[model samples]
Target: MAAFPYYDTPAIDALNAQAVALLKLFAERGYVREEPAVLQPAEIFLDRSGEEIRRRTFTLMDPSGRELCLRPDLTIPICRQVVQEGRKFPARIAYNGLVFRHQPGEPHRATQFFQAGVELLGLEDRAAGETEILSLTIEALRVAGLKQFSLRIGDLALFGALVDALALPDGWRARLKRHFWRAGYVESLLYWLGHGDGKAKLPGTRAEIEALLDARADAPMAGRSREEIISRAMDRAVEAAALHLDPAVADAIAKLLDISGPAEGALISIRALLKTAGINLDPQLAAMDGRLATLKSLGVDPGQVQFTAHFGRNMEYYTGFVFELWARDKEGPVQIAGGGRYDSMMEMLGAKKPVSAIGCAIRTERVLAAKIAGGA
Candidate 1:
């Protein structure tokens, strides 16, 4: 088999052309080109990129026993560069590169592909920042000859605010956040909350958990010693209560997730949910409105954008505002581009302080495939 994919003349040319055009857009907007190393520390991804990406990552060990992997995505490696180099804030950078992924038994899945996009770092004005990133992505698609696409937007920060307002137990907050993006999982979680056997859904009574920690008091796990585990469990005793979800709060969350349509209509539904929950989310609502206004000012029709509460795309680092652009096809809608804000990623990559950032990428292969199919 070939070391890498072999593309025919037309497809190769198309990829090259799309990359150049997309990079030009970024360049004109002050984003300098950046290319991170192809091989990176595997743990960086395994620890931060979420289980979906982790499972598909192509990992290996070097001769010296250093764990390494081919880059699964450009965003993390680029963020790693920014933190390591102490790059100045408000930096605009772009990259056109290949990312690798492999599945054990899925031969037909894409193993590698060309991706081109930009990341805007340290822009604190979120409304303007989101608008800039979304607009740039749309323009890049336009340059790639894409004409019709649906923009689906979601805000994790908004969802987080609602969860906080609900006053869920600390342990349950983590569990719910973990499943926030999975529509089915979230629905089931809400069900468990409204109708679970009291105390049975917990990891065990506080004392039982502590006893296990004490018994394994010498074994180490994932870097934590048994003593450390016991101490941690002791700290978590208050949080590990039975799964008790208030029926009203569960209904509110379900309603929020179900609010999907034009931007304005979604906002209306969100406000209703907040009112029913007796929570004042003025600041978050204002931020969402600001983003919508920013999008409108960028020439996108607010009516065309669909906003939803549970729209995370499985990228673990996306701290707020995720979106995907889809084009209609004979089979259904196919995503051509997607990305979002990941303000905490730099910290995850070892930064000493918080860093603000947002970015998106276009799949050159997918764009070309759509073009050839005459569907997008």
Candidate 2:
């Protein structure tokens, strides 16, 4: 018979040692190390996580019949810990633990995974916090023996601004943004913008017109016919036209769709796009730009890092920057580490104030696999 495999294998031992060393480094940096409970109240996760996440959580009843769930992610539970303990702001806490999510028949995607990260609370300096989190992530990846990975960053705030600039109806705006990252929806969006194949129908336009017409017909004018109301609605449509595309709005959308090149070039293009759109460079945005400049000054090659405008992870809670590290040549499940900013999460978890939080989880098995494949 074949020899039984042991968790004490040299490869696994090496990865664990690296993880412990990184954890110690984080602790030395004034990050309060805490081991979070592996299980938590199911409701806590269900309330904050998006619909897709809620479905995947591993849940069961406790001894007293209280619903319990194996932690799906650390951020939410950390928020819960803060709320329960009434922790003060500007608090820096770090945790290293395994989280469980239910996945049947998915061997590579295990139900159990390790998460190591920090949450910085009450930091009014959003940009500083974002920069620190990203820096920490890069450092962790380097320590974990991942050297040839590029950071793909994006801002939901910029995307939100583009949406507001469009002046699209509320329903349409919501629908379009919901489908923005979806594959095969680019043509649909272009169609909605009156540029591509006009296949999909916009709902409720006729109903809205009919409602306006009926109200006008019932107004002070006595015995007004329905035809008059329809005529008035048609006049309104002709005057307003079909949501004329503002040049600025067009430029913003174009920028988001234009995902190419390395980080520096992307930033230059983004700045130009914003300038053409007449968007005043807000201090928050400026600070982010400055942070990138600092990173470049530190000898980090901007050309080596890709900034994808719409490259968001599947997670919905990421409010600011999001990134994934991948091997330069590997194709399947290439992620080595990934995380982003989640400012509003504490509030979502019933905390008194917003927590300025960012984190990255390194997939140890994947890291080891890559290292071995690279003959490291």
Which of the numbered candidates is closest to the native, going by highest lDDT?
1
Where is model 2 more than 4 Å wrong at Cα? Answer: 1-6, 9-12, 61-67, 102-106, 168-244, 247-255, 275-288, 328-333
Q: How high is the CA lDDT of each candidate model?
A: 0.81, 0.67
Question: TM-scores of all models?
Answer: 0.84, 0.74
Q: Worst lDDT window (10 residues) for model 1?
A: 197-206
TM-score of 2: 0.74
Worst 10 residues of 2 by lDDT: 195-204
Q: Write the per-residue lDDT of candidate 1 for residues 1-376, one digit (tens) a residue.
A: 1235788898688788888888898899999999988899999999999877898899899999999999999999999888889988898999999989876576765788788989999888977788899889988888888776778888888877777766667767777777775658877777667766344634445568767766876765888765666567656544545446677778887778778788888888888877887888899888888878877776777767998777774788898989988775445556879999999899988889888899998877777766666755
lDDT measured at residue 366 in model 1 versus the true structure, 0 to 100: 76
In model 2, the clashing pairs are none
Candidate 2, after superposition: displacement of residue 174 in Å? 6.4
Cα-based lDDT at residue 230, candidate 2: 63
Model 2 over residues 1-376: C-alpha lDDT tens digits? 0022235578567767877877876777678877778878999888777666787898999789999898898878877778788877788878777777766555445667666777776778877777777777677667776666655666665665556555567756676666655544743464446542332232235676677656666466456666675676566454335655554456466655666667767767777777776665464356557757756764567765687777663566777777676753243436667777777787887776566766666665566666656713
